[model samples]
Target: MPDIKKAGNIPTSMLAVASLLLSAPSFAEVYVAPFGGYSFGASEFNIKSSGVGNLASDEEGELKVSESAQYGVMLGFTTTDPGDIYLLYSHQSTELRTGNNFSPSPITDLDLDYLHLGGSLYFPKGDVKPYVTASVGLTSMRPSGEYANETRFSMGFGVGVAYQVAPSFSVFADARGYATFISSDSTLFCNGGDCLWSISSDIMWQGQVNLGLKLTF
Candidate 1:
């Protein structure tokens, strides 16, 4: 009876060890994810005019910002431990339209896009994960009419939360603020050969709110 009891305990211990080994490999496998969402925010265009443009001020401000739809893609790989680290890259783009209240004045359509490469540190508690991240990348702003393309080197930082709902699905929300260096150039006006103007403005900081779907693998 003593030998039978010892033999039964040996198989139980062995089964427990096997279970541990099977779950261990899951901690190191790479994870891939892609997401999309909408953005509702403001894109402030500071127009400083030279060469006969108009008269709003030495600095013209267009603050008539409206809600817009934006979409993007993201890829990330994370360590599988309960609390771990991850690196991700994502690209998001949107269109902004701004105009002055007065007529005969030129309307500006500003197309803005962002490219982000960042890393995140996550503290996961069961199905809920909270994370913080920092990213440095490019912001491209293009104005219709006579303004040249403006590209800025910007840095962003934010904190957000994600909740896993199923085996390979989650929902996330994030809000990030950008501090950027503004670089501007002007183009020749289409009306005439001599219709050329140079515009300059001070760089302004902006913020955005994003909510979307997250797919985890």
Candidate 2:
């Protein structure tokens, strides 16, 4: 009779602990993310050393999203708390205008297919968790035509925050910029390997915007 109610509370606490232990495995999370946004950056077209005539000195172009932007979907699996890795399949395209120096002409468009392997680190905070992620993998670009088909290495890193809404779902936004380099031996349209008149450039860089949803198991 001294503490009948107090004795019952002890069993209640034990039951709560057992429930959490049972649910732990089911709480392991997996996320499939799809995102789309705009991309903007600059490119320099160098005149190949063996060119017949010099068109311009490393033509400066303005990056636009006319038909260009970084958008795609990715899948992720958590290997540990505050740590996870993702496989990303993304498409990025850009329109560059030869602003001045060069004569006005049709716009040159650049598009790329990226296959990325990367991981992220999450910082445990209050309601919002911030993370930094980096990826490195393969990328392909089809500048204007098929003859310029090129393959190269690509990589990117960014930091962003996500707010927890439900136990199984969270929304996130990130800003990332990436670059890749490919070598060209054919000057099909190029006066030389390093010439601007050449349909293709010796190097390329892209900046991307990422926004998407994350679902957790």
Candidate 3:
């Protein structure tokens, strides 16, 4: 006859798999959210047009980026603590204008993109939840007219609320800020004779507001 306790014991591997399954879907989930927004905070800087990679040139003019539409998507994995970790990607198409903000000026089209790994913490109250989030990532700056592309380290933070209408769906709106780190005097957007800008600031900032729908499963 076999020992009763030994015979009744489950295999360790079997127990492990069982624990994982029970702790998984019930305690965690994955979600996808798509958002549309307007990004403001058009940053203005001094561009040294005659420098040609020279940072000390005094011949400079004010340049400004125009505010424009932003669109993005997030892929997130929820935690047991009513929050989630997400990867975010967003883009904006705008223009770099020379001279005053309201004047008709020479325009150079530009594209800005951000990629971040981020997380959120939530305050759940009934069907509504409020959350705060933060992230660190990279920003890619692409300028037209023979300028070279530049990539810089960046950070973002935001606060928002979401309303759940079903077990796997919700809608949310949020406001966020993005700060990009730059070398104060590097030839970031210049490409030779036509090159005009060595970034004048050590940091650049922008603000955005978004509205979106989330699907969780």
lDDT of 2 at 185: 44
- The model with the greatest TM-score is 3
Distance from true location, Cα of 32 in model 1, Å: 5.1
Full ranking by TM-score? 3, 2, 1
lDDT of each: 0.54, 0.62, 0.80
Predicted model with the maximum lDDT: 3
Candidate 2 collision pairs: 29-217, 47-194, 47-195, 48-194, 48-195, 190-198
TM-score, model 1 to reference? 0.61
Candidate 1 regions with alpha-carbon error over 4 angstroms? 1-46, 52-67, 80-106, 145-147, 183-202
How well does model 1 score by local distance difference test? 0.54
Give residue 67's lDDT in candidate 2 (0 to 100).
37
Clashing pairs in 3: none
- Count of clashes, each model: 0, 6, 0
- Cα shift from native, residue 3, model 3 (Å): 44
Where is the poorest 10-residue window by lDDT in model 2?
186-195
Between candidates 1 and 3, the lDDT winner: 3
